[model samples]
Target: MSDKYAVPNKLPAKQVNVMTHRKRRLREEESHHRVKRLNRSFKLRSKKRDYKKPEFFITQYLKAERDSKRMRRVIMKNNFLKGVDDEEPKLLVVMHHRAHRVASKECTLIMNSMGLNRLHNTVLLKNTTESLALLKMIEPYVVYGYPTIQTVRDLIFKHGFLRIKGKRTAINSNKLIEEHLGEHGCICIEDIVHDLFTVSDNFKNVRSLLLPFSLKAPRDGWSKKIGVSYSRGGEYGNRKHEINALIERCL
Candidate 1:
């Protein structure tokens, strides 16, 4: 056969290189799978050890029940004392300070129900026994206290927003207020502040029109970690009347 037309007895250098590359890739893939298999085996062994027994969950449930009862007692006692003195708070300002990552499903539900789904969001709630009970259950995730009249006024004037038709709108004019809340007798911003501060019958209607107040971090920063209770020098839990001071800094 003519040399030009004859097939080569040995493969070209390029073909040899391509074959070697394919073999190298196969080896690498094999090694990767081996490593993954080893890792998966180790993980399985660790998971076996980490698995919690049913008894462990039972103990956890019992502990939670005990804590719930204890908290209920404390709330009832405080409410009783306040009632005796006619000093029970009419309204409470609750601020959500922590993130949902650390909150349980129950706490998240309560916070959402109270319009406190975001960090640093504040809402005004009537200080009913049921409300207090729910707050105590999620005490670790919120800061609450009785807001003064001035604080109520400032919050409504400064941070107050309305969720009109699912849109967040500022309280810029009395007309907007009258449009949404005139029937409830809250015809203006001042009416909202007055109703909220006095916990009047129109309070719930006014609150329904307003969105949760989104506040800034305090100018001086939190006194301690956000997870700590206010009584323990942290920002969470009830701050009593001190919430007004916190609100001022945030505003």
Candidate 2:
């Protein structure tokens, strides 16, 4: 017989057999395919992903949050502030951004000296329909933040977004608001500040101030008489300690 087609002549003497060898080879190949299919299924169920996030937007948000916390720390000093607790601010110095922090600090200082801290009034006004509800709830002083370029934009956006349709709440207007104060009563702003802060030399006779440190100039018509102006925040930069002196003079 030809060698290619010939059966093994020595098979009878062999320890290993062709049938056993063929079965082992088929088992290995079947196991390999089974393992491959299992791997494919596992990959399909895996939670790992190659997705990435938008870098710039995330960085901007993080930066803004960090800045906000830092500003809050300076504005809401533990020695003076206790957060917006069960009580609201009495002299609500409304502000929008970085200047917001300075205005808040000034007002806080003003309120502390004027003794309005005892009255448990005042709070920052947010532009929201819920803000109106909260206003009714808190009866805040509506001190305006300076309508600076950005603040003006923010105001327009906020007002457009949060304004209510019904009659907007009117700020307080009357003689009760205009108290006699400041250097023999010659300066009207001091008395108003005092009323807003609720301070007295006698340590008594006072109520909460409404939005006293606000960016708003003095109330309408009386602003010129009182010499009120929109104070640039820059004026307070190095002379911050002088704010205490200015407030004291008013007191």
Q: Which lDDT values do the candidates have, in the order given?
A: 0.82, 0.34
Model 1 TM-score? Answer: 0.66
Candidate 2: 10-residue stretch with minimal lDDT: 221-230
Q: Write the per-residue lDDT of candidate 2 for residues 1-251, one digit (tens) a residue.
A: 77899777665634457777888999999999999999999998795766757985576566556545644565454322323333432222232212222223334454344323433122233223343332222112222221222322222223211112333322233332233222333133334334324323411222222222222221232221111222443221212123232222222
RMSD of 1: 8.4
**Candidate 2 Cα RMSD (Å):** 21.8
How many steric overlaps are in each model, in order?
Answer: 0, 8
On the 0 to 100 scale, the lDDT of residue 176 in model 2 is 29
Candidate 1: clashing pairs of residues: none
Error of 1 at 223 (Å): 2.2
Over 16-134, each residue of candidate 1 has an lDDT whose tens digit, in order, gives: 99999999999999999999999999988777574788997786677556556756776677753333124767889998877644325555677789988888899999887778778
Q: Candidate 1 regions off by >4 Å? A: 1-85
Best by lDDT: 1
